[model samples]
Target: MTKKVCLILAVVLMSQASRACDDNKEEELAIQQSDEYFARAYGFTPETWNTLYHKPSSSLQDALDVSPYEGRTLFKRPQSSNNSFKKYFNRDQEDHENHGRFAFAGLGANIVNTGLFNNRYTPANTWRPLITLAKRIPISVNPNFNNPLGSFDPCNSNGGESGICTSGSVCSLFGGRPSGPCDQGQVCCINVINSCGSIVTLNNTYWQTPPTALRSPCTLTVRMDPKFIEQKNNPICQIRLDFVSFTTSQPTAGTCTDTFQVGGVSNEVPTICGDNRGQHMYLHVPLSSNNPTDVQLLFNFASGTTISRSWNIKIAMLPCGATYLAPIDCLQYFTSTRGRVSSFNWQDVAGARQLNNQNYNICFRTELISSQKATRMCMSVCSATDGDAFSITTPPAVLLVASANTGFASAVTTDAMEAAQNSAVGATYTDQSRANGITVATCLYDYLLIPGGRDANNVEADRYCGNKLNPSPGSVKFQNVCTNLFQQRVFISGTDTNVQVCTPIRPFKLTYQTDGQETAVDAVPATNTIQALADVSNTGFCLEFQEN
Candidate 1:
């Protein structure tokens, strides 16, 4: 029995020791699992853990535990690779050292640990292990505030007619009607106020309607609001009164009486009021009224009660000189010169073919129509025969005749013939005679026709001469003398002439015919048919005449 008892005791002692060993193994596994969880949550590696903890592990178990989840770490890693959690740990440790308190670390650790304990036995609580202490750090919150404009009530809903105040939140005036419980930051204005104890401003919509009309012997008064006036920087502002429309019974001027008064002082009224009905008439009146003052408009029909008058007026306050840039009464420049007329006649040989001599004479005389000034003139000639060219000349006999026509004492210089040249139907030639700078308007011109050339082909005669001459058949067609004579005149700057520029003020052309002892002006080669071509080449003259 003694032997059996000893053996039993030995067995019991061994069993107790084995059970103790098993408990130790389970506790070791729990600790290892907890470390793995932290490594996964905070991206801790054995290298990093050693660096942060400042100590090496007893075995490679802590380091080896980090290998199973090399790339599969769940938490975000710190930017630094050497020690991932060192900064966070150091921050917490600093707080504790500085304030003698655990700061966030103690609280976060307790919450995470408690959560882990509660969910430890259950695999269903996947989030428990993932819960991190760092997430417990406080986050700030911000909220938006309101603005002034949003606080006001909408205009239409507050008690006004619907269509008039359709969509705006701000109150406004419409055609002399008031409406709105205006939105914030906007003021309400009235349409028309007879007595303005304060300055009255008409909203934009009020101008849409036509102004009211007042008749003769009637008075209209308006008083400005003092508050509105004071807000303007200029204490002395001007009021612009527009007479939009006016009508009077009488058509004569000075028959109707209408007047305007500002601050009890009568002002000058518009003259010729009846003539400008329906036209815009603006009046500016200066106002120095610090208090509410009357703007009175009075009409007196005392002269004639039968003379009835009516006018539509619009009023606005503006800074001085606002409408001072009024319309100007401008004078027009004189387009033509005033002068007397002078004429002379010449009889010349007419032949179907070229004349026997190479040239024939045509003559004209000029007399001063006005005060003597340098003048520019041009002349053209036309004849039935083509190639009947003419040139101006100062042969002694022709010059003698011209000198007699001018009535000048000494023999006039033949300088007038300088501009003369053989005529071409579509070509322009200037009078070179005026080159010597003749200030006297009186002069004479002589042209010699050299008739050796052949006739110019009549191209589409009907279009040119207003006559159709049949080329064949017994076409006993009478020649229209009017078609034979084409004359043109050119005038350079009249009294104020610029010879260098040679500005042609008025240049015209005419056609004439001599038949049955009668001379009649004919319209041909129409006006502006010949234009002074500008010499862009800048060669001879500033301008030269050319046929278009």
Candidate 2:
């Protein structure tokens, strides 16, 4: 404003007769005094301001004083002062609604790309929440709660670990410790949940063992907030628990001493105990739950036992219809086409022991998206060099006797003493050892089922148990190495030398089931407390699959 405008206000209300004329003369005089110096005070207006707003309202001669401007001011142009707020931040225009980055984030929905490809492809996953995100978010609010802002940034830490990316104030608000730096002036907040009975809502949250040793049961609850659920555009389908480091009291004879189990899931997860490092599980989540779902991971330690225990499990929430999503009902899913698959409690401590009463399918990735093609897949046991690697209680060969000399008859002898004398089938042994391979007997209980397994010549195969997964039903002479290399493969469709490891058809899956009745040495009985076979505690199957 010019000094003329300031001086004109001083002469207000002179006399009714000369007031009008006096005011006009005084305003003109004031403009002449300071108009040249302060006229340029408006300065050069930038394009952004010009597009969103108008110029200063008038040229020099119109007024002697200026009116003030405000944010969200209800005053409009032409009606109120020239500098009154427009539609930018003022929002005084009743017809306008909310629309911006900050506004859409609170609405919680997947962005719909109607024009171009979505996931960076020619035609990406064009899955959108509703008809359009813009229509739903404007002037809308979540019915459950208002404050739905949360931080679930999985790509936040080193070594594949994860943390939440949010402001320090939000970190403190959620009782999280601000760690590394994040984009947009935010911090990588990590919420280390060590206490039992604590709820886990953030994806990639870590559940670690308590600092001080306590025999009490530890439990971590999981549930999604409505805001988070909607933002994902689908309900939680599976919860993957990655055991980065896990060690507890090993199972005692098929039963776990210190158990780790999950509840409130649609599918079943085995209760296991032992050293299971670098293993993961895909827990099935229930469909609906009044909006948010609830799942619990529970651990129990048996009392009156001296055993070391520790665990660091990373929890991941997978929404429905997501990329790299595992098949439903699969207990474990291996994404990489080339990786080893281990049992829940299977460890290398005491030779190798398979957990009893385990019934779950382990899936391998067969179909790759985004131009990745892989049709042929194969799984092989530890290897021929490691003789002790294959042990699943396969029945004895009916043709080969303790010695190759006695042929054309059941290798198993009637007298237990006589069988041991010839190293024949049904021979009792103290230590863990392979029994016999390629037997005609059916494997009813405690066996690994590799559906449609075959040998080099495509000979049909069946359930494999009792020691080795021999490729063919050849005599004991062929059991050694140099047995055709082509036979030792379990294919995406077929093939395996000995120890039976198979799958569940398409998508390439293997089912490992163990009935309560294990191989009983005393006549191989199904039920009752019969003596367990000498190979009761033997190395479980350790097979590797490759995608080609």
TM-score of each: 0.23, 0.58
- Mind giving the per-residue lDDT tens digits that candidate 2 earns over 1-548? 57865454343222223333344444333223222211221111112111112223343332233222100111111222222112112332321221121222223331221111121111243453443643554322221111223323444544334666555645654456777775455677776777676766666678888887664678888865333322232346668888989988866666777889888888878887788888888787765644455788889999878877888998877544333345665788665547777666654444446676788988654534344446555666655353345455433322223323433323332212211111111212221113552222224455666666654456434455555554343323223212322222110111223433333245566777765533444433465323433334444567767665
For model 1, give the RMSD to the true fold.
39.6
What's the number of clashes in each of the models? 8, 23
State the displacement of the C-alpha of residue 429, model 2, in Å, after optimal TM-score superposition.
21
Candidate 2 lands at a TM-score of 0.58
Candidate 1 residue lDDT tens string, 1-548: 88976775575455445444354354344234334432332233223212111233334454345431121122211133233223223344533353222234432342223221231122443454334643663221111001111111112222322111111211221123434433223323324433212122321111111234333345544433322211122221334454454544332211223332234322332323332232232232335534434555544443544644555454544332111211111000111222111111111222111111111111111112253321333322323232212211211111212223444432222223321121112112332333553222110111111122111232111000001111111111111112123222222211111111111222221111111101111323564332222111000001122211
TM-score of 1: 0.23
